[model samples]
Target: MRRLRPVRGKERRKKPIHDGCFEIRNPARLLVVAPRVPCPVKSEHISDAVASVIGPDFTIAFQPIVDLELREVFAHEALVRGLHGEGAYEVLGKVQAHHRFAFHEACRVKSIEMASMLGMRSRLSLNVAPNDIAGPAECFHTAIRTAERVGFPVDRLMFELTEGEPVADLPALAATFRSFQRFGFTSAIDDFGAAYAGFELLAAFQPDVVKLDVSFVRDIHLSAVRFTIVKGFVAICDELRIQVIAEGVEAPEEVDVLRRLGVRLFQGFLFARPGTAVLPEVAWDAA
Candidate 1:
């Protein structure tokens, strides 16, 4: 495996967040100025100053998304970690409200740059907030530019819609999905059956993939209700031509239940944990 390059400047000064465009000072030079106005979905925005502060403080981690039927890795989801190997919660706690947009953008750029450096050939799935997709033009440009700069193929990228915040406009969000699809990038509704990513979201837009939340996967073999629910999801997704990925799976029993339920993709501890700067090896026999 190739070693990741060290982040430059161990100690850096923090810059105040700004509403308008500002200059970013980081090693990758991937961030650009923010728009003069705030994002339509949210009042706060991510400026260049925020990018400068958050960019270097974080690094990318890769967690394998296994394909059981194919018996190979389908994708490596890019998770954010601290520059010095801190947990995501610890690193994300430092981000203030104003830093949301810039932090999100920084994660995307960093993920692509690191994935390229690591010579990742599988799809790179990125977690995206509803607000980010609500205003897809800016985010799209940044992703396209970063992919070009790092020589990563655009078609291999996947955007997983996170449900941290509820999407107020389904029509607009659906339109955004179409915009991304036009560019050859696939989309996924993450944490299905939980939060705002329920059946309503599925009706609004049929993403290329749907990740069944841990709640649905946990103890599925023991609980008849869970089994029936997951089976229903798999059946529906199959009809819609949407791939189902059972995430947060941790037991062989769970895998047996999921496979019987027609789930071909799996992610969680049973496979491998997220490698801080490396791709963790998958335990193929576990499945």
Candidate 2:
């Protein structure tokens, strides 16, 4: 994983694009593809072994990325998919109806397990609901321990707080985060733009990093409103000296604009697509 650092103005690099897809293995030790949208697949023989709890309905698939610089799989963000003809928003409701928090937690653990099997261990950025931060420390202890057992760097893993829910108690949240810090694990508040910006959390919690939501970067050059918002974000980060990352940068123009605004760190298709399909996407892009 590359630490965020200041960059002198230079040409933005845009080279790769990612078509996202993932294979999911259920707890039952069965393999299934988390379809982009809900689609009917032949399940005749499959029903004999175990009935489907999570049918072929729309569920999210997670894409794991390998950081080329470290030659390791740093983290995997959970991406949602819709049901047969259902949009992500609809599927989200279904997931919540089930065990949304538990599902993501399991997915992160599973993804990390897969990464570790492949000897990829830079960090794991697990997307999670904001409210679930209320869980007991035991909730995350297993993940930390698992990473350790697998020889993964505990400090390098990033637990992404992806929820937009307001931080009800900043001190309490910080206390929870401190536990991770004590164990040498770092944290990041992901999707900062779409969610309500938690300046208090950002300032007080002092997370290791903050991920600028991709929405803020999409076609940013054309959107004055987004540019102002990003500029303001960059300004605040500058003051706090906190690291900020621009996500979903797909065009050279976007990179150029962000560079001019003093945004040093960025991630998107313009740089490399997700998946271990090809390693060192970032390193090769720069070199």
Candidate 3:
């Protein structure tokens, strides 16, 4: 794992491209927030405020990513939920702008802690924001320390760059990926072909994995255009030595079409719904 370096006095004032507030969206819904400056409060003060707001109200659910060829779970994605099992949107909706940074940090720490407690042996995939990596290194250190404390191997961890917003600094993001790679951590672009995480992102930096957006995998067998586009994407990823994982595959026909397109890793309802604090079992027969 990469060692976390302390920020020097000169380093504290340097500004990055993602210094302002940004919105993050998902396929299900769009979360719109006004653009704001970085939180001006002291780190410890904001941390206390965030802890009070987030508290122990959030928990993680594991959704398995299955490998068709191996007929086993390739990884388990950790999804955030409320302590009482409310959806991610409900849990995250309460987070104020100033609390976003600490909220993200808490999610990382909690996810790793829960996954470790669940005795998860498969690679654990966690959602991450580009800004999180591009910003301070504290979040990364917190995750690394939590993993080490819980005895989870850092190499088995994968960070999925969520395609919730446009990346303001591609070069910085790419550099962050390279740095993580040097530490035995894998990088992936989530929701590929969606929003800004398209061909441009691939050209800038080829992640270890590319998860095709749910749009591409939805009823693909019924649409030749979708198939062709997906085929082209698969071919491109193949040439780049990047593994492609088809997301939101809910039908057998979709699986067949994706398999023919060379997508071996899969994640969606066709396999299993996310298990609360446990690794969900895959439904092989469904595929």
lDDT by residue for model 2 (1-287), tens: 22532223332322211211111111011111111222222222222212244444533333443233343333455454543445546665655435665554544554455445444433456665656676436446556556556565444456777755676766767776765554445567877756655676676676666778888888889999988988988888777666676777778778778877876556666655544322223432531
Instruction: Tell me how far the alpha carbon of residue 57 in candidate 3 is from the true structure, in angstroms, after superposition.
Output: 1.6
Show the colliding residue pairs in model 2. Answer: 38-84, 74-123
- Misplaced by over 4 Å in model 3 are 1-50, 135-139
lDDT of candidate 3 over 1-287, digit per residue (tens): 11111122321112222322111111111111112122211122224655786776777777888877767666788898876779988888888877776798778777777766677766678898877775335435666667767776555677899987778788888877765565556678999888888887888887788899999999999999999999988888888888998999899999998898788889999998988734666678897
Of candidates 3 and 2, the better by lDDT:
3
Quote model 3's TM-score: 0.81
Cα-based lDDT for every prediction:
0.73, 0.54, 0.71
- What's the distance in Å from true for residue 89, model 3? 1.9
For model 1, the stretches where C-alpha displacement exceeds 4 angstroms are 1-50
The parts of candidate 2 lying over 4 Å away from their true place are 1-93, 96-98, 164-170, 276-287
Give per-model TM-scores. Answer: 0.81, 0.65, 0.81
Better of 1 and 2 by lDDT: 1
Name every residue pair that clashes in candidate 1.
none
Per-residue lDDT value at 72 in model 2: 38
Judging by lDDT, tell me the better candidate of 1 and 3.
1
